[model samples]
Target: MYDFLLSDEARVLRSEVRDFVKTIPRQLLLDMDADRVQFPKEFLAEAGKRNLMGCRYPREWGGRGLDWVSTVMVMEEIGTLGYIMACTFGVGAELVCDAIIRHGTDAQKEKYVKPLLKGEIFAAECLTEPRGGSDFFGTTTTAEDKGDHYVINGQKRFIVGGEGADYFLVYAKTDPHAKAHKSLTCFIVDRSEGVIVDYIYGLMGCRGGGAARIVFKDAKVPKENIVGSLHGGYAVFNTMMIPERLGTAAMTIGAARPALEVATGYTTRRKAFGREIAKYQGVSFQVAEAAMLLDACRSMAYTTSRAVDAGVPENEIRRLVSESKKFITESCQKVVHNSMQVMGGIGYTNVFPVERIFRDVRLASIWTGTNEVMSLIIASEWYRKYMDDRASGITRDCENDAVEAFAEGEKIYE
Candidate 1:
C-alpha cells in the first residue's frame, strides 16, 4: 500500500528525508537524550537553524512552509532517532504553532509565533488545571478585564513545556457569567508577567520536554493579547484538533516503527537454547502480526495526511482525522506491547527503547482527546449524519418493507 500510495514526487521527498535523517550521528541524539529533563533551548535553536522546528508553518512566518506530509516525514525521522527529540519539538511545532496560526492576532503572531518559529523560545498550552485533566473547559483559572489589560489568576497543572517555555497560551474564564463553553477565552500570556511555574515534573517517559504545574498570581496580559474573539476559546481548540490529531498520529507511527524494528533485530540476533529467538514460531508470529498492524495504522495516518493536504471539507476532515488518530494510537500501543512481549526481559530493561515507546505511546491515547473521546466524536458524527439523511428521505428501511413479505415467504417454505 505504501508503494501504491506514494507518488513519484512523494517518494523522492521521502527518500531525501530518510537519507538526511540517517546522517544525524547517534552521539548527538544521545546527548539530547541525556538532557531530556527540561527543554534544551540551545538544542531547539539548533533544530530551528536546521529549519526543523518550523517545518509546517507558513512561509510568511519564517517556516519552511512544507505541507503535512513533509511534516509527517520529519516527525517520523526524528522519532526514528528517538522519542524524546520528536515529542519535545512536537509540542512546539504541532500544538503551539497550531494554536497561533488559528487564533492569534497579527500582533500576537508577530510577537510569539515568529519567535517560536525561530525556536528562540519554547511554548506551552496551559489548559489543564489541578482539578481537570481531560475536562479542560472545567478550568478554574480566571482572567478579568482591567481597563488596558487582563489580570489572570489561577493554577494550571500538567502543562507540557511549561517549565521552560517563554510563552504560555492559557485558557481562562473571560466571562464567568457566560454559560458552559462560552465562558472560556484564550490568551497569549507571556511568561514574564509575574507568572510563576512551579511543581515541574519528570516523567516515566517523554522526559525530553518538561511538563510543569504553573500558578499565575494576578498576571497581566494586554487587552490586545486575547486570541480569537471574546469567550471563544472553544473555537481555538477545535481549530487545532484536526492538525493535532494528524501530527499525533505521525508521532505514534514514528515511535512504533522503531520499537518494532528494535524487537525484530534483537529477536534475530539473540538466541535461546541454540537457535535465534526469531526462529521460534511464537516470536515470528508476534512480529508478523505487529508489523502488519503497524503498517495498516501507518497507512491510515498517511491517508489522513493526504486528506488534509487536499483540503477536504471540514467535517469530513474531522472524521478522517479522528479515525486515523484513534486507530494509529490504539494500534501503536498494541504494537509496542507486542514488541515488548517478544523481547521479554530485554524489552522491560532501560537498555532497550521499547519500554520508553510503550510509555510514550500510551499517553497518545490519553492526550489529543483520549481514544474514548475519539470514539464519541466519530459515533456522534455518524449518528448526526444518519439522522440528517433519514430526515431528508435519502435512505429508506428496506428491512421494514420486507418484514411482512419475509414472514409470508417463511410460511410458504414451512
Candidate 2:
C-alpha cells in the first residue's frame, strides 16, 4: 500500500532489503530465541553484503543514501522476521552509525562506517549504567584523560549485542566538575584490552541478540577515537536519538502488523460454536481494533520520519519523535495483545508467532527510553513550544474569550 510513496530508488532498495530478509534461516530465529545463538553475525554480514545495512547514509560511506521513509519501509520488512532481528539490524545500521554520520570526521567514517555497513564488523552504543538509565546524564562511567589515551572505567547494563560487538560507542564523564550536559564525552572504543562482556541469561524476551553487561576496567582508548569534540557528548547524544527512537518505533510497527495478520488467519480457519471464530463479533472486533491501531501507528511513524527528513526544527522534531515512539510502541503492544486475544488459547502458545511477538513487544515501552520518558519529552517540548507561541503572540489567546473573562480571581493558581 505504501509502495506508491516510495521513489524508484527506494522501491528498488526495499526489494533488496526484502530479498535479504527472505534468505534468513528460520532456524536462526529459533536458535536465537532458545539462546543457542548468542548473536547472529552472519545476518548482518549478509545484509551488509547486499548493501542494505545503512541505506540512509551516503553512497561514499557504503549506504545507498536512501531517505528516512525508505529506511522505515526497509525496517518494516526486516521487522516481520522478528523484533530481535530488526533490532540487530537497527543497532549498527541506524543507531550506532547515526553518531558517526552526524558528528564523526571522515576518517572515522572511513574506518568504522564502511566496514560496519559492509558487515566486516559490528558496533554497539553503551549508555545505560548499573546505577540508572532514565537519568541518562547520571552515568557513573568515567574516562580519565591520560594524554596519549583515555582510560575508561565503568559498567553498562543490559547491552544488546554486547558479546558480539567488535567495538562500542561509549559515553563517559570526561569533565567531572562540568555541568551535566557538558561533563561527558563520546568515544569509539575497540574491543581490546580491559573490555569484558558478561552475556546475560534467562531473559524474559529479546534473547540471543547477545544481551550482556559490558565492563570497562581501565579500557585503553586512543584520543583519536573520541567521537565528537571534548565534552561534547550531549550534542552527539541528541543527534543519535533521532534514529534510535524513530527506528525502534518503525521496527515495532513492522513487528506488530504481521502478528495481527497471523491471528486474523487463525480466526478465519478456527472453528467456534458452529462456524469460523472470525464470524463471532468477539473475535472479529479484536482484529478490527488491532488493525486500526497498526494503521494509526504506521501513519504516525511515516509522518514523523518525513518530519525528520524534512529537517523540522530540533525541538519540534524531538516532540514528534518522542510522541511517535511513545504512541506507536504502546499501540503495538495493544495490537499484539488483541491479536493474541482474538486467537484464544493457541495464540498464547509457541505454535503461533504472536506469543513470541507478545514477549518481545513488552520491551517496546521499556527500552529506547521508556514510554514514560517519551511522555516527559513530549509534554516538555509541547509546553515549551506553546509558551513560545504565547510569548510571541503567534497564537490567539483563548483564555480571554472564556465566559468568565472578567472573573480573574476564579482562575486561581497555587
Candidate 3:
C-alpha cells in the first residue's frame, strides 16, 4: 500500500517487524505498564536472533546492513507494541550502537557494538542531566583526565534503559576551560561499581523499561574507551541528533495508527441516537481528519528517512529532521486525542488502548529534543538558508505565478 514511497524490500521488512510484534502477548504489554515485567531481556534476545535489533548498522556489527528507511520501518512496527518497548529497542540499536559504530575504535565496536546488536548486552545514552534538559552543552557531568584513565563524576536523569543497560554511552566535560561545545567528550562507561542506578521513575506513562536517574561517582574508564577524539564530542552529538529526531517521528506514527484504527472501527459499529455513529457527519469528519493527519506524518517521516539514506547535506538534513520531529509528534498527539473523542467515555477507561496511547503520545512531543526545540532549529536553519540565498543574489520567490505577480508592498509580510 505504501509502495509509491517504499520499495519492495522496505515493505517486506515492515511486514517482518509487524509479524514479530504480533508474537508479543497483550498480557506482556500490560505487565510492562504495571512494572511487573523487569527488563525484557528475553524479548531483546529474540529480536537479535531475528536480525531485527540494529537493522541499519553495518553487517559486521550484527545488523542487517539496511538503510535509514528500513530502521524507520522497524521502529514503526515496534512502536505499535507501545512506547516503552519501542524506546528500549531504539536506545540500544539506533542511539547507542550507532554512536559506537560511527565513532568507536575497532576494539570498542568488537566489545560493545556487536554484543549490543546481538542483545547479549544492552546500552543507554546518558545525555540529559537533572540541571539541564535541552541545554546539552550545559552538562554538569565531568570526566577528569588522569594519567592513564578518565574519572567520570556526574548524574544523568531520565535515562531510558538506565537500570538494565550493561554499559552506557556517557558524555561529560573533559576541558572545562574550553567553550561548551568543544569541552565535552564521549565515553563507553560500563555499569561497574562506581556507576549507580539511583531511582526508577514512576512515570505517568511509558513505564516498565526502567527509566531512571544514574550516578557516576569517580567511575574510572580506560583511555581506549573514548569515543572519537577527546573534546570533539559535539560532532558526535550532532551526528546522533539526526537519528534520534527522525526515529521519534517514525515511532509516533506507529503509536497513533493503532488508535486511529480502533476509533474508525468503533465509529462504524457504535450507535448514537438510534443509528451508527459513522452515519453522522461530525464523527465521520473527525475520523477523516485524523486519518489525513496520520498520512501526512508518515509521508514526512519517510521523506526524511530517504533524504538521510541519500546522504543529503548535513544542514539540509537538520532542517528537515527537526521539521519532521516537530510536525509528526504534534500531529500524533492530535490524532490519538481525536481517536479518544470518537470512542467517548469508554476510551478514557483502560478498556480501550486509546487512553494508554493518549498518555504515551504525550511524551513524544516532549522527549528526544522537545517539539519547542525542534521549532527553534527549523526556524534558525530556514533563516540561515534565506540569508545565504540573498547573499548569493538569488531572487527566488514562492513558486506560485499569482504570488510572483504581487507587488512587494502588497504582500502581507513584505
For candidate 1, the C-alpha RMSD (Å) to the true structure equals 3.8
Which digits, one per residue and each the tens of the lDDT, describe model 2 over residues 208-277? 8888899999999999999889999999999888888999999999888889999989998999778999
Q: Deviation in angstroms for 35 in model 1? A: 7.3
lDDT of 2: 0.90
> Worst lDDT window (10 residues) for model 1?
28-37
Sort by lDDT, best first. 2, 3, 1
- The list of candidate 2 runs beyond 4 A from truth reads 400-404, 407-409
Model 3: per-residue Cα lDDT over 42-140, one tens digit each: 778788877788888888989877888888878888999887788888988899887889988889999998987887888889999989789999998
Global CA lDDT computed for model 1: 0.78
lDDT of 1 by residue, 252-280 (tens): 88878888999999999999999999999
> RMSD in angstroms, candidate 3?
2.5
Weakest ten-residue segment in model 3 by summed lDDT? 397-406
**Over 4 Å off, model 1:** 1-36, 392-414
Better of 1 and 3 by TM-score: 3
lDDT scores for all predictions?
A: 0.78, 0.90, 0.88
